[model samples]
Target: MLIDAHCHLDFPDFDADREAVIERARAAGVAQFIVPGTTRRRWPAVLSLGARDDVSVCLGLHPYFMEEHAEGDIEALAQALEANPQSVAVGECGIDARFGDTLDAQWRLFDAQLRIAKARKLPVVVHCVRANDPVAKRLRQLDLPAGGLVHAFAGSPEQAGKFLDLGFVVGLGGAVTFDRAKRLQRAVQSLPDDGYVLETDSPDMPLAGHQGERNEPARVAEVCRVVAGLRGQGSEAVAANSTATARRLFRL
Candidate 1:
């Protein structure tokens, strides 16, 4: 009963055989997926896939793809969420300091989406890169009603605690499986049990040995296994707790 909590099955990467990809994940014990929308243009495809019983949808503007966002996309997102109450969360949104030029723009956009989530009483699925401090600061200030997920989190134990204190869960994925990710691995090992969630961010963050290849939800089981080993807990127990944490976070 594993859940891949941050996959992007809506992207064209799976257009040729989306159903088959899902079947493979099912075979690998992944029973559900949380597909977060990166931009408004991809919302229809995301909504289409989320219609399935096994998928949950989240809509937002990704900070990395700031260029793809339109002037009124935030308003459009609000309308979309209003029209689709079934949409569980308001994200795939957050700041990424990596993009120097769009730093200020990303903050504005991320804050706007956070406001929508706060108003709508829905959770969020955040994508952050090199900006945990500001993200935590803003979240503490905004205090969204439904706490969000810090998807694919790769930060220090202290940083993980900061986000958790601000009512967000840290998402650990394939990065934890790499030997070189000693800092991230240590953070995973020491972070409080209730402060974390499992995610794949599939079709993107591939596992250590599978670099340069297309990642899929099926590999989340492997993620669960590695994380369990790091925490010195049984894989089943780790999976159960993380799955429950996800269900709690997204109300899935």
Candidate 2:
């Protein structure tokens, strides 16, 4: 079974046909979906979606929408975590230097979530963009017992190695489908057996040739196939390995 270790199926893009979308994923060999919240307000919806047998949830503040997060948002996230003990992880949280306005605020928000995750011994589904060093630094400082994932990783070998050293796995998403993404493809190919997991980040990060279209968990099958091709193995082998890695990390 394949696990989409990161996605946003709770987002409005799937509101109309969410059930059918899930069925399609199941048909495509995607057995589990990790729907992570992008903000505190969306946690309810995320939790609602996660109520299904095949879905799990991760809640945190995404840096791209800084203005929407208020002062007590982190507290709200912590409460959400407490309220939904079944939630698999603590993120959708991390630094995104390329977007958003406040670097300081992003760090503070991410730091608060990390503290909660670390204290509760929960794994995080981190969202990092153009800020791997600072993100790695913070994770090292937290020294989380459960460790976490660096979702949609687009970095060099040295950077990916840093996250791996911190007990984190890289999430290969729709981005790896592009022929131009040779750097990311190489990283996926070179990672150790347990060093990577697969994600869709659905409704975003659409795969190559899927630009301007909606992405879905079902497409993770293609992602798994691409990774298998890169690693010179069969798709089922990559699926099993990545799914096992996700189950271990998210405790699914």
- Looking at model 1, residue 162 earns an lDDT score of 89
Q: What are the models' TM-scores?
A: 0.98, 0.97
- Candidates in order have lDDT scores of 0.90, 0.89
Candidate 2 wrong stretches, greater than 4 Å: none
Query: lDDT value for candidate 1?
Result: 0.90
Stretches > 4 Å off in candidate 1: none
Model 1, residue pairs in steric clash: none
- Report the lDDT tens digits of candidate 2 across residue range 213-233: 999999999999989999999
The TM-score that candidate 1 achieves is: 0.98
Top-scoring candidate (TM-score): 1
Predicted structure 2, TM vs. truth: 0.97
Question: Where does candidate 2 clash, by residue pair?
Answer: none
